[model samples]
Target: MKLKLTLVLTIVSLSLFAQTKYSNEFMNIGVDAAALGMSNAVSSTTSDVNAGYWNPSGLINVEDNQLALMHSSYFANIANYDYAAFAMPIDDRSTIGISLIRFAVDDILDTTQLIDDQGNVNYDRISLFSTADYGFTFSYARKLPVQGLNYGINAKVIRRVIGDFANSWGFGFDAGIQFQTENNWKFGIMARDITTTFNSWSYDEESFARIQNAIEGQNQELPESSEITIPKLQIGVSKSYLFHYDYSFKTALDLNVRFEQNNDIISTSFASINPALGFEFGYVDMIFLRTGVGNFQNELQIDNSESLSFQPSFGVGFKYKGIHVDYAFTDIGDQSVALYSNVFSLKLDFSAFR
Candidate 1:
């Protein structure tokens, strides 16, 4: 059963177009539980290390050296994920950040060599392999002279490995900006792959020949060596309100714009938009509760009817001094198509020790 599943995943991965619709998708999984709980609403209000992934411009709000870490499991524990990031104020007007992320399915059984060339069934030929993807990002943020305005840029590197059988190296750049109004309203914009990223793939011919017959007629030759990633944009707006002194409320909205028409809620010739909405309640800046809804899609029914569906996420956070802990119940895909996972993250402020 496991072997069959692995084969399916491998086939689907290799069958995509050179200029795919979803490229470097692992970056969209999000880093912080707090942000995921809000469906990545923090693009406008992010203030910590995780902002390196959400919107680098927000990193300018980091008051001190900060570090963050996160872990989660997916596909019924068949894959594991880890994320880490660090950010520091370079000066009064500039900040720098670095982040690393990894996702992998380990210990997959390789059955390509299960049968010998002499038509002999060899039970000991089965071996284990893994498929993994990694991303490293370096971010820089600068507060512009314009009041309440900040800008940021990111240089990203991507690495993917399939148990030594195949590998790829990719590079991309991202840019972002954030602005605040005197009245507390915030706005942000993030552009990913601003220059169009590309991945150069290479394969081991020896290993490649072993599974050339995974499908009846497919895999007859090597795949294209290059994969291009088009640009994507996210625009966000947010506001926070205080109740008396301790209780607080915040709401955020984001519009994700893809340069292609798809099953998004709003589609046009030039772009498709997916809107996300999030809400949070806070107490004394120490405890927080959050909820969000997003991932709108038009699903076709058996009767050829269209139905709208969305994913909802929930999370809680606790903070003491500068140490923060957050947990989120979220799904990478729509709830109907994938299992929900529990995610946890930690953030620590080095200045708190001083």
Candidate 2:
């Protein structure tokens, strides 16, 4: 039965990747700390508490109690993301977690204008508006000793709030499988964002009724309706090597190929390949330095310029007793200077039950 399920998941992932019109909404909200470290490639390893966001199957390797928090400052004055997660082992072979992620787009200038009776120039005042996106996740992982494998699933409730305009709600799921060979080879697979698109992005008529009445009273124009769709579908694989040396060194490489199906005019289905590599060196696992490269692609042809850019990232981590602290920096390149596309994240981990 497990084999059959895995095969089905593989087929569905491939099919989704081949589809066009990918949505880009909710893309920036899924960010996490470990992901910030390796350019968002924490899909396989069970080394940290952030695994709940990347590959839940990794939870099988977790012991005792775990708590983690991650925050990211994104491009623009738009929004910032904050993530928190907690995991605990139910047994030697089972683990469970709960996580929350919030994306907030701060004060934005509201451009709606109120004109005078004669259609003459009138004073305009900027009103502040903002958007908030949030998600709640419940995850579970269990190990199958017979196959030397571990599997997990995550169920989520997603919500979005855009000022006084409209709000949306949706549901989604993620699944993952991981295996280790007797020779110490590790392999993993994950399917993310599997669910239907949100269709509840509706506004309160009462909020706009006042404006509508004013415009109607003056025989002016009315506002048009607008909607947004959240993107879905991601599949990834990862592998790692553990080298036995005087000082232990571990290296890992992960690849994720994502596809979005556009459902609205603002989104277009596109394909992207993200590859990440990280190296960890330490003695007795006290301190470590990690660096990686990701998002390598061909020339990106924009309006008037052709640019080739890839995001590179670096991080450092420290472990004391059962507490861990990690910091990472990611570069967004200069293709669009105004975008200010750089990210920095910090994570704190604590093992309460261990």
Count of backbone clashes, every candidate in sequence: 0, 8
Which consecutive 10 residues in model 2 have the weakest lDDT in total? 11-20
Candidate 2 regions exceeding 4 Å error are 1-32, 113-126, 196-199, 206-246, 259-273, 300-308, 332-354
lDDT of each: 0.89, 0.60
Candidate 2, residue 193: lDDT: 62
Which residue pairs overlap in candidate 2's backbone? Answer: 21-261, 21-262, 21-269, 22-260, 22-261, 22-262, 22-269, 23-261
Q: Candidate 2: what lDDT? A: 0.60
- Over 1-354, each residue of candidate 2 has an lDDT whose tens digit, in order, gives 443343233223222322223422444344543455566655655544566777788888777777777766666544687888888889998999888888786675443333455655343643556667788889999988667688888887777666675566766677888777776666677777655344344555664443344335531232223323333333444444444643565566766555642222123357455565665556567676666666554453667554555666777777677667677766654233434333434444445333
Question: How many backbone clashes are present in model 1?
Answer: 0
Q: Score every model by TM-score.
A: 0.96, 0.74
Local error of candidate 1 at 176, Å?
A: 0.3
Best by TM-score: 1
